[model samples]
Target: MTDLAGHEGAWREFRAALASPRMHHAWMLTGLKGLGKGQFARAAAAELVAEPGIPQPPAEAHPDILIPEHPPENKDEAKKREDGGEYRRKRAIPIEEIRTLIQRLHTRPTLGSRRAVIIDPADDLERNAANALLKALEEPPAGTYFLLVTHRPGRLLPTIRSRCRVLRFNPLDHAAMERILRESAPQAEAAARAAAIAAAEGSPGAALDFVDQDLGRLHQVMLRLIAEGDEHFALRGELAEEIGTRPDRERQQAAVDLARAVVAAELGRGDARRNQAVIQVHGDLVRLSGQLPTYNFDPALVVMEIGALLASLAMPREAA
Candidate 1:
């Protein structure tokens, strides 16, 4: 019933650790994005906090579990009208919140002796917040458990990694990704579903996000552009005309994302020249994607440049 198709190994390893007489107080569920590390951490935390013979409560209502994420800057205000109905979530988890959670962790658990603190994507923690967390991890309470989920464990303090048992989650296989799509988006046409899975690169979350953005059509366009012997210049112009002409931020991002996916698909082949070109192009695209908000640049112009770059990369060198 649980969606852990590609992670049976991790599950077995966790279960083995649980069966041991001495249980670790801190666990780091670390892996690539969209591999369900947060989900697994929450499930384990719930199970850990549940009383004997009773099912774990929903994460939102679990008394023994505390999830401290990024709260809005203005804690009192529900939201600003112009910024939408709810206050925008802060960019980082503040130190005050982590301190509060640590204080609670040291106290006796209301539900039982066991308690859990789940920090999803712990990478978002600020320096002070991370240090606060590190202090708790250094000497956690007797019955407390810290479940930290991070897409990039390398970013965390080395001391924090040393204090926890690391569990790595790998990307799902193609078959498992397709199965998940079939269940989650059964209404999608067969071709669309296939495109979504291809774009996902074995991550169901990526597939869902792609399909939601209607990127299947863009995928087809990118595939044709990259096909062998294709005329890259003309294809680039056409793609720029189609995607770059729009000034919308979302559209521009989707166009760059599609192009990056193509580059990723073509990377690391035996062709050294092609690898270098795609890598450079992909890097520029990534940087541009990040800088879009800061400057008032024309989306079409940026994408056309990207197209031209890809074309140059695809061109065959002059015959020897």
Candidate 2:
């Protein structure tokens, strides 16, 4: 469990829940990506599995632990529907799967003090699956625990969120990020340490992304856009296209982080022009962040929309 980075005070939170006369059946462990929600759930699971005399859960084999992933068993049905062959399997976690998980929870644990089911990114659950989960949350089996980890807790069924205890996990601090960077890349410790501290934005897991060496380029680009601004059509377009092609949602967030960094750097310089550019671009980033969850938005549209906004910021303006 030491391997899980960026989450502190997890044990305290867990103990608080346990101390209650009646622990909530469900828990919404919400945080941004790579903040160790899964690890926290696992640690909680260990406690649930730990017998009165046992110090820890059974590491080798634990019947009380359950972790479900995406792309449900009926994913073939989803592909068929997408291809227009058959209309079926509309979402990631299906009702039947949730029912099965529920059914398993009905019985006493084969081994351990209690039973626990961890649904990582529980927001991915289909509407029907979520409804089924809601029922279980309403009438939970005694001694059973439901740990739902999600980056987008807002997407979950409102009823589900209301019934559960919510625990928020904040990102890592500079010292933590530096320690992680040092352990991962000793050879580049100095540079990695600095970049991780800068790019982390309070998440140690994000620090690893800097190892790809793109952090410098990212910093340079944001610097120019915030300072000199970019009138070069090709240069602006190039950056847009590159961002458009990045599929990882977190990278999109990182782009937003880069915008925030631009704001910070420009504000410190006290250059009115750069400050104005930073403010405008930061607004654009806020817009883009809101748009990211829509699956139907074209990558090009995203790029062009934000790119045009960035391009407009290049123009020198009179003080307001």
Candidate 3:
């Protein structure tokens, strides 16, 4: 239960629930990406499984607490080069994991009177897996608690949503974000930190990403390209080559995110025609970003297209 910034209200609500005679068996912690919903879920679960007057054990060591992982597949099979020597692609929480969790729930708590299960970003549960989990939520074992952390609650089964008490975690404000940044990124330069804060738009996790990846430099390059427009084809080519072919996945993601933020910021400015152009580019960026992972499109081509979209923003308006 480390210090969690920008979630005092949620903490208070949770404490009140614990104090109540009738506590909720299921809690859905919902919020945007990079917020601390997952952290809060783990902390709450730890509290539930801890023995009275004894020090709480780390999450990994607690028998009464479970956080489901992507169950291992094909243990006999050797790693493939295409798979980066391992299965690295995003995977869903399969039905086997939920079934196992449910089996464990039937047993008595190992330490405290309560047992806890945390499904982080429960959004990753496969369809069958989610259904299996739904059954447990509907008829949870006595003294068992489920904490489901989700960035998009809409993706969850309606029945699951109905069963859980939803706790909405809001984004961190400037002060809270600063406190987190100071602690997590103490060595980050003031300029880089400021840029990260501005680009994060209230998500301390995202701010940390910007600082850790030195995305502020990338962001400045993006701004320069936007300001200079399509006149510099070579510059665009270089920019595309740099991010598109990089082995660093984090840099690629940061670039796409920053690009969208820049275009979104431009949407409300200028006249109707210019605003429309910005809107179109913003939509394109969103679509492209989504498609990149699913379709496995060439990264360089995507970067080039993104550059073209930014260039379009600088196009001159025809005389009225």
Candidate 4:
């Protein structure tokens, strides 16, 4: 397992739990997105199943560890194509997936005395799936440890939340973020790295994503447009074309996120009217961006809509 960065406190807590005579079977790992909560869960699971004097196998090769059938980050939605079908994007952990995991937990561990069940981002669980998982957590099989990763703990059932010990993961510090960036993207340009670090706001995963997709350039464009209003539609069209033309969901998400960040950076300026306008656009962006996944809206149209909202911030109060 890769060493998790900027989470030493969490590691120490987990290790202490392991060293205890009676370890908690269920642990809730809560944090913002891309803070390595899932990675920590996997490492902890590996520790549970690890034996003395034996080499640790990769997560997938371990028989005693179980993860969600479809990890949220990698899950895709199948779109009907003329040729047949192709996956685009999808989200959700269904009841059947949970049931399968539960059934497997009932069996004895294949490799060790303990088994590890990991639900990456338990927030993605459907209502029925969450209930089914709640039952497992309630009466987990002996020698079984459940590591639930949740970016939004509030969304989980109160009963489920009550059953497990919660470990909060905070954003990484600048030093930790830099160390991770060096390890993850050794060849990235200095400018790109700087942009990613600033834009990531202490999330290594988000930073890496920005670097991998070359989103720093897009972020710069957003900042420039926000700073200097696009009197003509030229800048907006260019940005929209760059993001909307690509079918990659990650790129689209990054664009929306960057735009929101740019607008949010303008908050708390001396001008109250401009601050209110920025606040409104930020909220609108959040709502509209959400619909992209739920309604499968056209990415181009969405970018245009975001552009329009952002453009409003550049307008003078006198013109309003």
RMSD of model 4 against the true structure: 4.0
Candidate 3 local Cα displacement, residue 307, angstroms: 3.0
Colliding pairs, model 2:
172-202
Question: Which tens-of-lDDT digit does each residue in 16-41 have in candidate 2?
Answer: 77877867778889986667787778
Number of the top TM-score candidate: 4
Instruction: Give candidate 3 regions above 4 Å deviation.
Output: 72-90, 231-235, 241-244, 271-295, 315-320
Candidate with the greatest lDDT versus the true structure: 4
CA-only RMSD, every prediction? 4.3, 5.6, 3.7, 4.0
What's the CA error at residue 258 for candidate 2, in Å?
4.8
- lDDT scores in order: 0.75, 0.68, 0.79, 0.80
Question: Counting only residues 3 or more apart in sequence or on different chains, how many pairs clash (N, Cα, C under 3 Å) in candidate 4?
Answer: 1
Using lDDT as the measure, name the better of candidate 2 and candidate 4. 4
Candidate 3 global Cα RMSD: 3.7
Residue-wise lDDT of candidate 1 within 9-74, one digit each (tens)? Answer: 888887787778888989999876667787888777776777886666787688889999777657
Candidate 2 minimal-lDDT segment of 10 residues = 261-270
Please state the error at residue 57 of candidate 4 in Å: 2.5
